[model samples]
Target chain A: MALSHDEVLHLAKLSKLTLSSEEVLHFADQLTPVVDYFRELNEIDTSNVPETSQTTGLVDVLRTDEVDASWVLSQEEALSQALKTHNGYFVVPAIFTRTS
Target chain B: MNIPLSISEVQNDLVQKKYSCVNLVEHYLSEINTQNKTLNAFLTVTDEYAYTKAKELDRVITDNPHAIKEFPLLGMVVSIKDIYLTKGIRTTAASKVLESFVPQYSSTVVERLESAGAIIIGKTNCDAWAHGASGENSDFGATKNPWNTEFVPGGSSSGSAVSVASGLSFASMGTDTGGSIRLPASFTNVVGFKPTYGVVPRYGVISMASSLDSMGHFTKTVEDSEKIFAVTRGVDGRDSTVVNHSYKAVSPTQKFRIGMPKEYFAKGLSPEIEQKVRAAAQEFEKMGIELVEVSLPHTKYAISVYYIVQPAEVSSNLGRFDGIRFGNNRDSFGEEAKRRIMLGTYVLSSGYYDAYYGKAMKVRSLVIKDFDDAFSSVDAILAPVSPSLPFKIGEKSDDPLQMYLADIYTVAANLAGIPGLALPAGFSESGLPIGFQLLGKRFSEPTLFELGKKYQAVTDWHTKKPS
Candidate 1:
């Protein structure tokens, strides 16, 4: 099924992406056939088949809840790559802003 | 003196005092400086880092000749795909989002390789976020196929394959979530081995599809690939999916039976590729091995299931790159990356989750079962790596579906979580490289390597240069 422009825009919003009007049309045209192609899976009968989310058979692999020094990233190092940082904390766009 | 072709040769020359490790590094560095403009294989060249390591290695070679034995990859020049995080080095994943992002820590693969004395020459280019089957999806620039610069190098491990094919590095590390490693290897005429899922830890490598991604590498020879695998494989206590197990080494003299899956040779495969791959299989029969015709009934559904399951996971993994902590804002994402993110969001959304992601998982189980049933009858499966030889640049880039089809023969191995080794089969009439892969049971990497070595023993295909 062809995705409508609005549907494509909805997906873009959910994905946190701001697509251009041209991109919305382009993606709608590009993704429609791919989504339609996914219909091929419906041809197979999978009534009783269990989902295989992970192929590794390991389950409930537990480790002690302790810090591992080797894997740790210091606060300074973690904030080094952020575009905005203040007092060793990552700064993100404000979620709530008061009106004047 | 001529450049060494394999790891053993590089070490032998070092031991013989034919050339210092610094000389070797300089040679590869000079090659990159000259050829990278045309090939666009490397996104970043670590000239200073490589020179420092080479100088240190040169000291060890002079002071304690026997100490060189301890370092398995001593003096070996290698490259990492831009997707892996290398501490203090810029890792872009070939996308503008992470254009100047310098990782604070290195991947487990990088640390392990360095500890074993491998000198990382640079980070190679690939499809942004490891999304496409052709190199054209890279945000930096498409990596040119060394054999014919006009043709595309199969990707998302595009530049890793090009580096090995063009002699920029002895071996290059790449991640294969679908056909990333094998397709590029096939297009560029190198040996690319994708180990069984969870065999290699994905500690700091950029996640594409967490469950499906397998860390692999490209090398000029199967033996060299095995050496790299030895250092890189095993559980690192970081990635929970990594299994702690040992692969039984296959005796070189042991006889074997290989299966040729009937579905893989079905319509749409180029007749020339079929003939060449079939002829390569016959070389094993001449070695007194048996070949059986097997069937994977769920084969046709692999690509469709992959598109669904992979994107679902990609949507989840990419959620971390929201520009809050690391990479640039979502606006910097390339077109292919945006398309995948949007497609994934649509599939995993509330109303469609069951129909897309949930149903795709059930089909994935069927794909796994197909491999289980087939492996029971034969020790391994042999198939063409790609349906056709490398196409020209811009040939299939316009149509995403056509680009996805380039991985038709390869995605099944990733879906099944089996180990696959793609090695040179022969060259097409137009001189493009053709390759075939050997698929084995989970953690059967040793057997696959042994088979690859056996095939390489009789055929000179892997030895042919891109000239």
Candidate 2:
């Protein structure tokens, strides 16, 4: 269950995080025991036990489709915390490029 | 009027016109100004806003005495943990990611508290993103235990506990994902109540372990905790997980059968904490309440399951913090945050999902079942809040697993989605406060509160000040 160096780097990428090389070594060392701890669950007989996504038994609790205007934040308010914004939309690194 | 007043005392004083709301607030701010530097309890002090609100409320109190009934929390001051968003107030969640980010909208609970006439005095410090049990996880700096500044304040509700313990605020709103409120409350000798999941709206608080988080508060007394709980509990459309039903208070009598989990008293629990908690359990027995010994066989697996599930949820929830849309880029996340995210990503990764996350979820059901079985026979369960008393600063900083184990007795409540109340049990031999927790069935806060009131009646531990 010990996470390899490359595996730790891959996890950081998957988590949308960038770890310094030092962090990789540290996390790799720390996370191994934590992962090994998870192995304890395997000893329990969970063959037919259902997975619990939420402790509270609520499921698919949908509200009315209409918006409550009073509580809704304006576009400007919503974009106020954005690190990069242009006009009313949040700006992000471009995800696509046209290649012929 | 005295500088430190309980919620009820403040109300009575306000009713008799002994002091204006402005005066009470000023006294509280003055205390904060003097003690906060050493306590490190607050992140931002909202002086102008607090004074303005208190002065306006004082006008209403002066104009019509009966008008106070409309605002139940009228004239009482409370602090909000930085994890809960407040409009125009900088909420760091004790992390650099949102160091200067102020939300345009306030959280649902804060709105409810304000409408009830509670003035926002300041923002308290906490573990970043409510992540660690120790206050050391905070990027701002660790909050000092008001009792002894040298010792660490139990956290991630560290500041919330410190504020109440130091007489700065009557109560503080804190989020408990995994004993964030209760653990600190134990260390500081305050009342920390984590209501059942889905009881309080989670709309404005920053998300951490979405399913595990519950919005609760720290108070000087169980009655104060109940009063605040009544105001803050309920469903808001924004947080669909909240329950729509109201909690009815039930009185405790001889018929109460409280359970003591045998596993909790086992290895790792400090001898002093176990002794104090056992003494408190004996008091309940003296009240004619039967104490039944029960076993939660899966107790050992709780910390493991929690670490897995919490990290997985944290990774997914933290995904919103991409540079463009949120406060800052992911790089700003601290070492603990990065560690959790990485652990989460590794577990939920395609091939490993079934082995780690999937298996952990199943064991989580067993942990819940252990409680369900125990609750069937007993009205509630009594256990130590933490395995040991609060340690010194930098004691567990280098070791993550050791820090995680500090929440041994507490994480089970979060995993089971039950209401857990931490109250002053007694003090350790060295004079540090030791607390025991009473956990009741989901939404059975009334039973826990009733028992807590009974316990506090016989014991003056909760009333003892740090000094």
Stretches off by above 4 angstroms in model 2 are A97-100, B1-5, B251-254
Predicted structure with the largest TM-score when compared to the true one: 1
lDDT of 1 by residue, A1-100 (tens): 8999999999988888999999999999999999999998899889999998888878998778999997888888888889999887889898998998
Residue-wise C-alpha lDDT for candidate 1, range B288-394, written one tens digit per residue: 99999999999889998889888888988887888989989988999998888888898899999999989999999999999999999899999999998899999
Query: First chain TM-score in every candidate?
Result: 0.92, 0.83
DockQ of each: 0.85, 0.80
Cα lDDT tens digits, model 2, B340-426, are 988888889999999889988999999999999999999999999998888999989888989998988999999999999999998
lDDT score, candidate 1, position B59: 88
